[model samples]
Target: MADKEPEALKIRREIGLVGGVALVSGTMIGSGIFMSPQFVMAYVGSPGASLVIWALSGVVAMFAALSYTELGTVIPESGGDFIYILRIYGPCPAFFAAVTFILVVKPFSIAAMAISIAEYAMAPFYPGCQPPELAVKCTAAVMIVVVATVNILNVRLAVRVQVIFLVAKVIALTVIVIGGMVEISQSSAIIVENLNVENSFKGTHYSVSALGMGFFQGLWSYAGWYNLNHVTEELKRPEVNLPRALLIAIFLVTGLYLLVNVSYLTVMTPKELMSSNAVAVTWGNKVFGSWGWIMSVAAALSAFGSLNGTFFSGGRVCFVAAREGHMPDILSMAHVHRLTPSPALIFTTAVSLVVLIPGDFQSIVNFFSFTAWFFYAITLSGLLYLKIKKPELPRPYSVPIILPILVLIVAVFLVLAPIIDDPQIEYLYVTLFILSGAVVYVPFIHYKLCPGLLTKLTTFLQLFLEVAPAEKNL
Candidate 1:
């Protein structure tokens, strides 16, 4: 028998450690750092508390990344959290998660990036020129088309572009860090105040409750480090590379985040950071004098780079889902010659453009954060379940039990804290959005896209194999 030609292994294993690192770093470093400080300042009154929030978020993110490393090494598949959940839980929940990603997470994320890009792009030429809503929509459309074009042409070419943009982003951030440090050294423009834990805790304005709420928001900004797992199949020697890539990426991004936040605080007082809409731009103006335009240009490049990286990685999740038969068949269809998932790519880009019309950047971030964390909580549960039920399964890389437990604790806090503090209408809107996936999942299952008998048989074998002793197993 012919070996079925390895199931059409079209994706080249050209992505090495550098590419893996780039994917993880590029995806995580996007608009979050640029926009999230304002939100963090609003939540936590003092710069010290804000820094603590980011530092704690880094630790939580590291735990989450370790948990994903265990799963990604075991599965070594492309669909990421979707695959992990499907293997441990069942098809129904996994299908819902996958649908939620396509319908909400991916599109909103892309739109958020595009909006950042458009805002940054216009800041220079138009100087106080805010484009009409329609113009912003057009800009988003153009961005989607350009990113899609680059990706479909070749994966290697696409990654090269990702590398260039990611490096540029790093440089832009470094510039800000240097600029801010210089400003701080020159004068006492920046304030450094220690939070009086006792009084701050007692005061309703600076209560522990408020800090906890702020911590959750800070955590959301640092959330996407695990997204690198979605491309595991394309990574060379994923067993070794996946875990290393995640750890390194998270560490680098965490340090960069701390430095960037410190820089923002160094140049602008907390009041200035909080009040200014364009915090980075304002910082640049303070430091560079007449050359503030240079910082605006850098911000624009940073946002564009982020937009490109986001679309490149986010689109892959949908493509992998479609290839697995959990989504529309057309999404699985690749370009015959180029070997790119053209249908999924186009579909994701189209949705991003549509979502760009309605809301500003923060709205999209809130929507994505709410849904992304919901799935993240589910993914962590799946890890714990598999660890208990399939303890014997080979895990070349395992998260220490304490870390996974900590991750679970933090994840639970992240989910509930948002609802407790904000309870913004958008929170309900996000919940409804996730639950809406069931609407499609039910009808699809009824039609037997996933047969009940097959699911039951798979579950039975899994349970039996897990529980059966070595002597009795044979």
Candidate 2:
């Protein structure tokens, strides 16, 4: 087998407009919706402000997407922010972003999503009992393998899987909205009075800094709006389709999220919202009577889709990073028959499995929410650099200069909010983790101290593994 010729591989451009939309929306609609409301309400201390922060987060995401359009369209590369930052800033910033994503953000996010999937999947069977912790971790580990296997086999099949879950999740959200509407109509007087009364916003714990922190927390629910951009190379008609899919997905998610929040508010007060860990399930029990278990299934499916999408896009960042010589070369190798980044998928899945043992979902969320926006701020800053440095570059899509500026401001605030609200050592630890990539890069790539060993390893990899044509650095 080692003597067998390596299979030729390249990312197939088969993902269409609908697939693109599904990817973006599927990645964004994770356990965040079910889990984030409580945290946001806790921070903001009111249902009204919680709803407002969600809306504002959506708007910020939309603007960020619009700013990203120019880069995704004009460059049309595989790595999203990695490529953008590389183009504008240099190799160092891009390497840091890729390392942070592959090492910390992506795997932690996947583990959290997988754990949520397992929690919802086991919820009905356990009833009043807490689901076994080992069972949850094992189930999540299995899901990580399943998703990785699907992507390793074929890209189209992976997208198809995403679309199926995406549709199921959408239908589930629609049902919840319809249920909320019915409840509102039946008790219009009470619901209307609850919504209109000024007391709704009169929580004693309201903190301005906490509201900023909450906005960032809610933004986590809207985090993966940029997933499609990560796979631009596989997207059909990326120039025209990328922007359309992004805008549609953002608007769709924003609307669904707002309606879902209103639905929760209609059935439960602000106090109840903060108290319930599973907001959707709570709403379902109140609204659907005996059929409430359906919501648990829906939550599982929602997290499943997000987990799959995370594997689909997150691996590409590592693949691109490796292809550019920032990491091990083996990860850049694509599958011969399927053209998938199989090595990258396997590496990402392995990390997720390791992280599953901890199963601390909220800690994962806090770490990711803080780090992801830091990259966003850096990417937007790079966009500003590109506009000034490469003024003559052809842009297929463009946003007002102010749009990127606005997002950058918000990103900076969100990135700093956690430390400002209540200073923590985790922020410093994450910073060291990100900067640690530089330690590897300096010895491995910049100095090229072990060129022969690295060459032999990459050659050995190619003997058994297929790879696409070497990708060029931006």
TM-score to native of every candidate shown: 0.87, 0.94
Note the Cα lDDT for every prediction shown.
0.72, 0.84
Top candidate when judged by TM-score against the true structure: 2
Put down candidate 1 lDDT per residue, 383-434, tens digits, no spaces. 8887888989999898767777787777676667667855677788778777
Q: Write the per-residue lDDT of candidate 2 for residues 305-401, one digit (tens) a residue.
A: 9899989999998888887777788888887667788888888988878877875777788888789889989988888877878888899888888
Report the number of the highest-lDDT candidate. 2
Model 1 Cα shift for residue 143 (angstroms): 1.9
RMSD of each: 7.8, 2.9
Show the lowest summed lDDT stretch of 10 residues, model 2. Answer: 465-474
Please give the TM-score that candidate 2 achieves against the real structure: 0.94
RMSD (Cα, Å) of model 1: 7.8
| Minimal lDDT window, size 10, model 1 | 465-474
